[model samples]
Target: MAVGSASYLELLLASDTDVADFDEPLTQARAKGAPADQLAELERERALALRVREILIGHRRHQAELQLLNDTAHDLAALHDLDAVLQAISDRARRLLDCDLAYISLSDRDRGDSYIKAASGNISGLLRALRLPSGAGVGGMVARTGAPYSVLSYHEDKSIIHTAEIDRTVRAEKMVSLLGVPVVLGRHVIGVLLAAHREQRTFSGRDVNALSMLAAHAAVAIDNSRLLGEARAAADELRVANATTRSHAEDLERSAAVHERLTRLVLDGKGVEDVVQAAANSVAAGAWCW
Candidate 1:
């Protein structure tokens, strides 16, 4: 029995299978009439194997998250449109969190509210266009606090200030659990990113961490997109300014050429007719005449 148990343990270690393999070995050991002590040891081994499997799974998940972040950064850099960038952020977040829905709310300081900028997964138009006033709703709380907020049941959670429009949208969408994190730049909360489930579910610490990481990435990407837009606009303005300068320089050069030609005519003892004709031709060719 001891030999059999030992061999089984060895087999488990050698195999690529996960904790599911534990059941088969334990059953076989029992059929082999293994002693109680042996069975206890086997149970311990099973627990250890499960823990190892969990660690491996967590490592793989972290790797996947990093890859997703990298891909998102590349997409953000390549995408020029703000809508496209927001859409990419929403899609990546939803896929990474495996949530029923994910969306972003951009802060509007002038209006003192947050408006939906992007959304993914099963969602209605009303929910997509939903707005949350500052200091209202879970998203607004995150915006105000600059932290991550989660609720097992949004309607049941009274701690968060609820607005009629947000409540109506949540009810219409049938969302049970919601998580929101601030998309902050420095100390300022720029926007909020939310992931919601249709069924009641508790968000684990890891879940919150992953969502927060994604939010951080999104915030930087959004800022970069805005900066890129401003840079393009500034470049266009500079181009226009440069063109105007060039036009003025050309006018001055033509004026100086005309003056020199008139002086040369005077020095050559030419008549007023020659100067008049030259000035007319020069004006027609290069300078504007009023």
Candidate 2:
């Protein structure tokens, strides 16, 4: 293998599209029947170049993923609309994973199951409405284990307990590959994030890690959104309560003022006609007395 300098890696970083400049010359040298030793060195250089290209591409992809995540975080911070955040998560997952579809299934602990809450890219109504029993499908397994799960070919995967409805839905969507990661908040698994492809595709460890990171952020965002919603509701309730308390205070103050006036009138030994006149003066001029 040809040893490369730090500068060479930096050059690749500068422009990933410059692969042809490094590859075409090596191809021509081989075709011209270069010396065996020279050819070997060239071949090593070519291999190193290819490796550099892969690294550059991976770096660029990772950067994109981070950018997407940062943008999502900003959006979540600005507003706590859960549906909007979930929808953004689904869309970003599909783009980052480069998959045909992506969806989030939230755990309904009360129901002991997970249900699809948000989806992006190609999807059917049946798939949208799909639910997985606890510890049943891939998502369910991820939910139970709080781990990441993947299958290059879902039809051939025997590790996951397949359900008839899930199988039918997957077939209908023509999804052959799947990757799911648990969305965890603290120690509890709150939901699962899923990425799917129509064709069989093997996901790398990098892919799994990227998806897992997104799942982690998603969990935080979901929790944040929920807390924000609760906080807003509590604030509204507090406002209503404050308004009621203020109204009651006003009513009490008015009653106390009337009582003070009546007490003064009695202390002064006012006649019944004088007391009635005082009461009449207390009432608004145009208001009717009961």
Q: Pick the candidate with the highest lDDT.
A: 1
Candidate with maximal TM-score:
1
What is candidate 1's lDDT per residue for 166-230, written digit by digit as tens?
89889888899999988988889999999999999888787788788778877877788779888
lDDT of 2: 0.81
Enumerate clash totals for all models, in the order shown.
0, 0
**Per-model C-alpha RMSD:** 3.3, 4.2
lDDT of each: 0.83, 0.81
Pairs of residues clashing in candidate 2? none
In TM-score terms, candidate 1 sits at 0.83
Off by over 4 Å in 2: 1-33, 272-290
Q: Model 1's lDDT to the true fold?
A: 0.83
| Tens digits of lDDT, candidate 2, 220-268 | 8888877988899999999999999997777777777777877898999
Q: Which stretches in model 1 have alpha-carbon errors above 4 Å? A: 1-39, 74-77, 273-290
